[model samples]
Target: MTEEPARRRYDSLRRTAQAQQTSADIARAARTLFVAKGWAATTVRDVAREAGVSVPTIYAAYGNKNGLTWALTDAADLSADLSRLLAELESAPEPPRQLAAMVAYDRRLFERAGEVIVLLREAGRTEPELAQAYREARARADDAHRQVLSTWPPGALRSSIDLQTALDIYAAICNIDVYTELISERGWSSEQVEKWWCTMVIRELLEIPTAAT
Candidate 1:
């Protein structure tokens, strides 16, 4: 009886691992199709075939293509280095260092979600759900900008630049699509993008000189 129960529990654990792997496979297939064909062109059936799973399995796992997109976004958000950035911002308590932290996070975000960000922008033009998701993503970014602005000590920002202006500058510079273009298409190195982004954002927003970065 003890052996049987142990075997059953092991089997259950194996099934759970298999299910997680299948979910990952489906998500990967869906992202590939969405990137290759755009949202409207890609269907759940295509994802299923690409994943080597049945259509019903795709439906059961993700419900539809939009669901898969959401999963991808969620994965991107999770994979980003936000927590470390936030911790750095909190601990540094200086504008230049905080800007570095933000740029570091932005670089990680590009590495993880650059294509997905571009895909959403393109698909949002046609898909209402993706449009809403894109809007929400911008809102989240705005909130992060506000957090970064608030973390700086007094006299950190340039006298000419107010909090709102600084926030706007943050939004403009931290754009994933722009960073992706600079790195992937324009062939700029990650170090180049990071240095330029830090320099520009610091020059525009901080009272400190850009050379500090």
Candidate 2:
């Protein structure tokens, strides 16, 4: 009967919603442990305990800790404001303003990923799949950089600066490691980091005219 089919469809939708909620809860719990302790140190049992789900459920949902790690990382990436930043960066005409936007966008990015980034990087040393994931994340960042760089009309960067070198400079200065150093060891506030970063990007990377004394 049509009524039977409709009932089944409703039940299916409810089940799918419940499953997605469960996965989200597990990923949220896993992120805390992975950030507080390294991913290598956090076990499936720990996540299950944190999430108030059974160990079997955790295994059934994520297969293992690595799967959960990927789930967390991927979820964060999906939730970030990268698309908006990318669009804004690409549409901006002025090179100095674009560079400022890039610096600000990266700072916001680190505000989200900066906390656990070092853990992910350190785990990559011994975990092959996580290493691949880390590489893919960096590749995505590189692609974003390339997107803005390629869209700039002529005279955006110094005529003498090659594209590849510019990209390398961008990555090196805007990287998470340097961001961590600024926050953790150097004791720079986020505002300070943002200002210093913008200044460096203009001075070191951009070809703005030198101010006459």
Predicted structure with the largest TM-score when compared to the true one: 1
For candidate 1, lDDT tens digit of each residue in 112-132? Answer: 777887777777888888877
Error of 1 at 188 (Å): 1.2
Question: Candidate 2 has which clashing residue pairs, if any?
Answer: none
lDDT string for model 2 (6-125, tens) is 344234324433454547767668878877777678899999999898999888988876677665554444334544454554345466777777787778768776655666677779
Stretches of candidate 1 above 4 Å error? 1-33, 36-69, 210-213
TM-score to native of every candidate shown: 0.69, 0.68
RMSD of 2: 10.6
Error of 2 at 142 (Å): 0.6
* Candidate 2 whole-model C-alpha lDDT, 0 to 1: 0.68
Whole-model Cα lDDT of every candidate shown, in order: 0.71, 0.68
